[model samples]
Target chain A: MKLEKLDPTVKACTSLVCVILLSFQYLVSLNIAVFVLSLLLLLTCTRARGIQVLKLLLPALVAAFGLFVTGYFHGRGTRAEDLQKIAAMPYAVRAAMSTGLYPALQISTRLLAYAGFGLLFALSTDGEAFIFSLMHRCRLSPKFAYGILAAIRLMPNMVREFKSVRLAFRARGMQLRWYSLPPVFTMLVNSIRWSQCVAMAMESKGFDGDAPRTCSIVPKLRWYDLAFFSCWITGILVGMCLLRY
Target chain B: MKWKLKDILMIAVCAVLFGVIFLGATYAGGALYGLLLPLGMPSLGYEPFYGLYFMAVAFAVYVIRKPGVGIVAEILAAVIETLMGNFFGPIIILSGFVQGAGFELIFALTKYKRFDFKTMALAAVICSCVTLGYNLIVSGYDMIALPVLALMLAVRIVSAVVIDAIVTPRLADGLARAGVLGGYAVCEGVAKDLDC
Candidate 1:
């Protein structure tokens, strides 16, 4: 399937639903199957694009691993029974520890599932088309919808402006802390001014909220989107039913 | 009142700024979480970073003083973050919607009139509850023991208060004092004093 042809709204809705279902599912095999399937779909859709997905998934994977470890230690197994079992042990080894597989699997798989679905939706869906569909299909107000679109478009320039601002601060013998609030304030004030200019320009060009307007390109659901959605839905249902749970 | 272009632009620009902030915070928080997890102390990536999530939402409300601006600003931030290849993906958007609604509800209940420190703190509490609820549902945090959950909630609330309530109102006021927010709602509240 060509990435551009997929309806953005459909992709978003389908992936969201899949992620929700996968969150509830805890079986390791089922999760691995779903993750594999999602990965395959991603690769199948766009092999080159899948590389980007893999790159983005790294942080999520690390987070998932952390969650798994946290769940293993802090899970419900810390009750009095497990506490006694721990005290009597010669040492706290992996073998001596009570099982945490179920909960840990649940957490990691849920994280992976979220990453999988997130990549699927984000990698394939066009941001502009998604915003357009939000207005046309979801009935978001144009003021807000186009505002978001404008913001999305401003992201690159915003990044550039942030760099330039930081450079100016650095040249002035100022070192900005990564988590410090001062640079954020500077960037925000500057961006607010930029947004004002954009708003003025847009209003001058007659972007009246009360006025009727038409889109240059309208997004409509097509057969491929329906097929894509149904396939995922059926796969999820089957996966749910097959899991022994 | 009909929302003007300036209002929309404020929301958009703020959303972009905060979205970038959020992405950066998530990376830093992720690294911190990675280090802390091995130290046998888990923050779940929320305790340290939770404040960044709601700062923009509260600031947007303070600036716009509109009913749905919190959610609007948050959802736009979520979109921008998604475009920036957020590891949490679109689910962060869902979290954004829920978190923003938490603040929006508080602001709406106050009739969008109260911008005090107490109101912002209370709003942060509500936002923390929403975050906890979402985690319980998706992250299986419900399966954890009560003490751990309480501690996580405590950290989240404290972060939200310190950042969202304290820092954000002051920042918004600072921007207003700088004459940048001349036509916005925050300015209107102090218009007489500032002679706007």
Candidate 2:
């Protein structure tokens, strides 16, 4: 029942299928159905986490609305089918909303689907475990895999560093602009220094590419992973076959 | 190219730094795009803002001056962003891979020797083109008019050139001048073994 137990590759593959299915699908009903299914899955996994992801979706929703409006206003050359759909509306209203309906729907729904699947995978999966799976199961070289894991591990410290860097700027009576280049520049300098130190420390500790290592938490594909894959793929395939604009 | 531990650690750090920046840009761009939607401009309004996305990888490759650093930095950044609860989720990993490959491919084309502004600009343009293809697939850009698409592409290319080519290298030069990047490839001619 805990989706987190599912193999990351399985979750990743399912998410890909969901994205592809949503991208190709234009029917609002199908998109809504998949969205609901995704929402259910997310909510069932962890209510608090699901709420957090929904909070994240707010901006995406805003962006999708923009895309919808843009598609409606400037999409140009309404399809004949769309024209027939708009044939009955008032001339003024129809002119604005006519040709763009399909496009607007398609773009907005695709964004929703993207956000939904993104939530499912990002919320449920553990980054360290995922990297472990990548190394053990996905045949990724340990150098790249461990490098990425190190980056992920360093994220919290990086955030703290970003704040300190800003404060250091302000301490000198210099105001930092959000869009300015100085903050990022300082961060990069700091990061480069830290990376060198970390690297040197790691090397001194005998870490090397040729060394064989074992994982603390081994990733395994359980029956639920298979079920998760089958359920999502079936839903997506069925939606693709049955749903049309 | 032998990847030393420092090299790998450098990639991780650069990727994390850039990933954080990318996260900030996403929110800022999203808010800006939302603000512009009520006006008539929809897609084009956000294309120029997209240059921020290229800053991390461009700066990383410039400083690192190695093959595959672009891909490593990018994909690592995406992983960090995902761990930070990015709204785009795991697909960002795929986006990072595609974008990094495009960036790395251009440097590869140049045999990894040229870190000139022109090469950086070219690589940025190539990366944007690849991202545009990705947009067409996921965002349904094919549904829009050709003129709009052309305009968007043009703006994107210009943005890429300005941010990735001009700004990133300038920033790297600044970092080098500050003596933080003592042993980096960018700082090779300046000094042998300065304190980092």
Candidate 3:
């Protein structure tokens, strides 16, 4: 099934749970399975293009490579005695092949698994749908929910304002560093004013925070959402158990 | 406890702006992490940018001076960052919560009355420690050598204290002095100080 068809909350929860579960274990096979499965599903089922996914995965790949090198040299199991502990484990547990190699593989692969789950949720879920789901399913306050939706709408304009401010500064022959306060101050001042205007406009339109309101676009949960959640969780759990030997 | 529409929008806008910055920092941090890999301390790459992560919390609480503003602002920023296609994905929302709770605890202890530099610095320190503990688990910092871990902690604390604590308050005050934050608590505080 396509992940995009699933509820946003379910996708988010599944990704979070998968990350948490994968963080505690040193099972290389489970991490690889998750990373591969997520990637395959993302490519085949989701609308996310392979190129876009590859671009996003580049950072994860780089980070994983760095972590692998770090973990190999500085990992807790670097000592020879630590190597003995690995050999004593069952056949399935010695998948790392040598001392310090287990953590190197585990951490680097776990990073990939995390990136996979993260990409799965991020690429498939729509922002508006997620906020609506939070409101309808999670009982988020209308004040905050609508506030977020409005902010999302304003994001493009905010970006434009940011650029114009920087350009205006440059026009004055002032080169503002990224860490400079003047540009941020200008932006904050504008933001405060804009926020006031937005608030006034919203209030004028009878947007009451306390009053119960109905949403025209309510995100509903379906049976497949449940199925997807369970399958994702159980698949990882069972995979970990089997890999434990 | 009552939040005006204006207040909520203020938080939302500020969170959105900072969320964009956070996304940029994440990319920069990723690059730095890759560069520092050969140093055997790849985790230190993001420490310098740690202060930027907590700016939403500091900005919101300092200007709004309300209960729970820090947590709300931080989480909202995380949500915005997530929606903007941050590579870290939804897990950041959880990190936001943990990071928010760090400073929120400090502000709550002060009963939301004190907005002094001392209080803000202390809150930043507490926040750094809290996030460090969370990172130890999620990022597996516990696996690294102890000296490297300690260095990372020190750098993060200094970043948090310098930017979120020192720079943010002064920046907000500058905005207030410019007379743009007129309706907010920061403006009100400035007005009262002038009257004195």
Candidate 4:
């Protein structure tokens, strides 16, 4: 396989992408409608489901609820039956609850939006485009850009193992004790072993050979890519107008 | 030192992995449900937070053993994430710089002599600590009372050690074992035919 799909023709696609990314500056902060649409565009483009988005969203919910719930009890200065105490400062607890809750949610929601866009980029767009975009267009060193591409290819498995660790520990009748240290250790050992096997396999294939790299699956930008960017950016601009009223 | 094609491939791969990690971290830390926990300790899904970033850098250093490898990998990854319009944007890039420094400092401390497993672990821990300290300041985790700050730091540091030293390293090892990373003997790959 070609390491990157760079033939002179792919340049047309890249220029179109440049235009689309330019539009994002406008749509990213417009309003809830534009933002939601952008979110939807990202979601549909990536082909991820609503549930997937929700999974990505779960963290924001947890942080907000956790801090708010804790802060509420902590505010009353009455320790509930099962709640942890938030230091016995007079308004400190309340301040933490009051001041911290919104920020936590805000910060987290913003995180979700970012992740949405990120997941969109990863799921929808070809990884090669982004990698080459950095190297060929953004002036990033090829070494660095390709490294990221390699890692992205390897990432799903990392997520799988991360999930596997959580599952395997649960299956083994392990209880959550002190950050699940024991299970983590077990997972660590296994993962180390996995890395070794994979590394050897790669080398055996002469991947370690001192051959120059070449692009295998280069992406070409299409009208859709351009249209998508325009929609996102213009949506952002329109939202900004609405927010003003 | 001249740049090699192999070096570029490795750096690019690790950089993207960096993005995947942060995406996982933020979701976990900020998630409302599926909160993985110990009896009393909160799992800082963010534990691996910025730590993965530095690992990518360190991995570059470990694999290439070349100057600027760590920083370059990190900066490029941050650029990808930023261009995708990450919420934190370039701020993440800034963190990458400090964390990269943290990784570089470890190699410098070792005088670039040995790239042992334990030494790499030490670097991960130290760099993570640097990130934690900086995160506290930037995110205002430092504004909390002394005890809370201390607790958070302790939790973060320990988690960083475990995740960096054990989980991530081993995962790289496992992939190597599965015959994925066949290029370098930098701990991201298997040490086959060794005197074990």
Candidate 5:
């Protein structure tokens, strides 16, 4: 079944669990498996384009490589004894027997696994569907859910305002540094004004924090959500057990 | 305390703004990390910008002056960041929660009254510590050498204090003075101070 067709809440929950569990486990093979499987699922089950997935993975790849180098050089167990042990090993085995090699691989692969799960949920789930699901199934307060939804809708306008503010500054012959505070402050002030107006509009429409409300789009939990969740969990558990032995 | 619709929207918009900033910081941090990779302490790169992450909590709590606003703002910011395609993924939501709770603990201890520099600085320090502990476990910072780890912690705390404590309160107060935060608790506090 298509992962896009699965419940967003379920996908999010699974991805969160996967990330947490993967953090604790340092098994290189398991991490590689999880990363590959997540990528495969994204490519096959979800409508996420291969290029899109690659774009998402690019940062993770760069980070993983940097981490590997960091761990190799500054990682724990780089003492004299560890160095001597590595030196004593045969030439072919020396690289593999380096003091921090194992930990480096573990850390890098774990990062990849995390990115994989993150991309899985992010690419597969629609933001609106996820929010509505939280409102319907997770019982999130309408106050916050709708508030967040409204703010999400305003994001593009905020970006546009940010650019216009910068242009306004430039038009005045003022070159604002990237870390300049005035632009940010201006944006914050504008956000406050906009939020106040939006809030007033919403309140005028009888938006009440305490009042019960009906939703237009309600995402349901299907049998496949459970099936996929259990299958994913069992796969990880089995991989862990087999790797341990 | 009852949260008005205005309070909710204010937090939401501020969170969205900060989320965008946080995403930009992540890219900046990534570049710095790559540059510092040769120093054998690439982890320190991100430490300096750690304070920017807590601005949402600091700004929201200071303006709203309510209990639990920091946590809500932070988590919302994280959700927005994740939706914006953060490279760190959904797990950042957990980091957001931890960072928010760190500052919230300080405000809670003050009985949600103080929004002063001392209080914010203390909150920033506590937030640095809390998130540091989290990274030690989740990000595998413990595997790094002791000296580097200590250095990272120090840089992170200093960054947090500068950004969250120094910059955020001043910006919020500036907004308050500009009359944009008219009906909020910050303006009320400012008026109360003038009466004294």
Candidate 6:
């Protein structure tokens, strides 16, 4: 990205990048620790930081509350302290349960982290530059990468169209009943047409039939990206290595 | 009336939408599962509802009412899925073939005569089996009991019906309304087909 608009895009791209990177942490406790740190990073960084953080906490809270309620009513409120009481059951199941929660937590964190990053990218990074990065650094063919990226950018509009079409039907006095399917079906067909129309328009404009193209903007990985990435890895490694107790 | 420019665009768009759904689900599902296996989950898995991918062929054939189009749509979807970084890597290509065929069989039974509710359900059912068979053969899920298989089958059937019967029909109708499905007799007359 040009120096003018780099900060936000890199941040946004990283969330997805980080999640993709997150798959590497499948071995042990490091995964959980990394996920927690990522959640923290996303909270501080995203524009709607307070609300975003709250959104993150909501699910975990829900899960924990559900777990607590289940244990309270069903398991007599099993707690960490009661580990000794249920000591008769085999260790593997217990171990697995504890580990299971960690992954779930991390999974949500990774997902939200990507969303935040997406926000950062959408808000800051120039879309063209970002696509260029994948083309240049990642070696993705410029043609395919840009074509798909352009298509993906249409996703929000597609979803919105879906909503409006429903509204349009309702405005026309059609009720959206379970058995009623025509109007909704028509909308689906229309969506398909829109894409093809766009594809054709692009084709007419020489977009789909090209071998490859070049971009004026090239993403240079700056000191900030390196710094943030290093800190991210170091936190996870330290957390994993030191928390062995 | 003949196939208009809008009709061609619409049908192509529907085809792409189908591709997107399949690719998106597979890519996201596989990535999520892959990530979960390491950081937190080593034991369980999600509800396995993307199992609907297995029935793509049947869904395509039923709605599109063309022989090769169903197969092409599924394969294209799988390719998109891979490009999106589906967790299973290249194997997704192979899965697309058998799963697409599973749904295709139901249509073949009616000899491609109709896209009626019964045929649609049959397509979904056969597809569910195809996916289950795939999971049993290639996927490493341990066979627990008759009950587990039964449960999985039930979930799969419900999902397929919802997808094929409800979602697919609505889409077919929309295209038909927009004059997109003019060439396909089965998908035609949506205003009369559901008798809306």
Predicted structure with the largest TM-score when compared to the true one: 5
lDDT of 2 by residue, B85-115 (tens): 7777778878888888877788888888999
Query: Taking the tens digit of each residue's C-alpha lDDT, what string does model 4 give over B38-101?
Result: 2222323345354555656765666556666667666766656654435433455666777778
How would you encode candidate 6's per-residue C-alpha lDDT over A79-175 as one tens digit per residue?
3433442354466755655522433333333333333333333333344555456566756554445445555555567667767877888899988
Query: Which stretches in model 5 have alpha-carbon errors above 4 Å?
Result: A78-95, B189-196
Local distance difference test, each candidate:
0.75, 0.75, 0.81, 0.50, 0.81, 0.50
Q: Candidate 6 lDDT, tens digit per residue, B90-188?
A: 345456777777777766667777787887877778877877776544432221234445655777788788777666665556555556554455445
Evaluate fnat for each of the predicted models and list the values in order. 0.58, 0.71, 0.63, 0.14, 0.68, 0.11
Q: Candidate 1, after superposition: displacement of residue B23 in Å?
A: 1.9
Q: How far does residue B73 in candidate 2 sit from its true spot (Å)?
A: 2.5
Docking class of 4: incorrect
lDDT of 3 by residue, A1-245 (tens): 77888899888888888788877776777888888999999999999998999988887887787778777777766444446657778777677466667667777788888888889988898988888787777787888877888877887777788788999999999978987767766876787688779878988999887898977777778999988888988998888677741
DockQ of each: 0.62, 0.64, 0.63, 0.20, 0.69, 0.13
Tell how far residue B97 is off in model 4, in angstroms. 5.0
Worst 10 residues of 6 chain B by lDDT: B38-47
Query: Mind giving the per-residue lDDT tens digits that candidate 5 earns over B76-167?
Result: 88877777777666788888999899989989998997888899999999999999898878877666777877888899899999999888
lDDT string for model 3 (B34-149, tens) is 77877876757878889999999999899988888888788988888888787678998899999889987988987998999889989999999999898778876666667766
Please state the interface RMSD for every predicted structure, separated by commas: 1.9, 2.0, 1.8, 9.3, 1.5, 10.5
Q: Clashing residue pairs in candidate 2, if any?
A: none
How does model 1 score on DockQ?
0.62
Candidate 1 lDDT, tens digit per residue, A1-245?
Answer: 66557877777778778777766655556677777777777788654365687787787787778777777777655444444544555564535445665556666777777777777666766777777887777777788777777777777887787788888888999988766556667777787778888889988998876668888888888889899889988988897787543
Model 6's CAPRI class is: incorrect
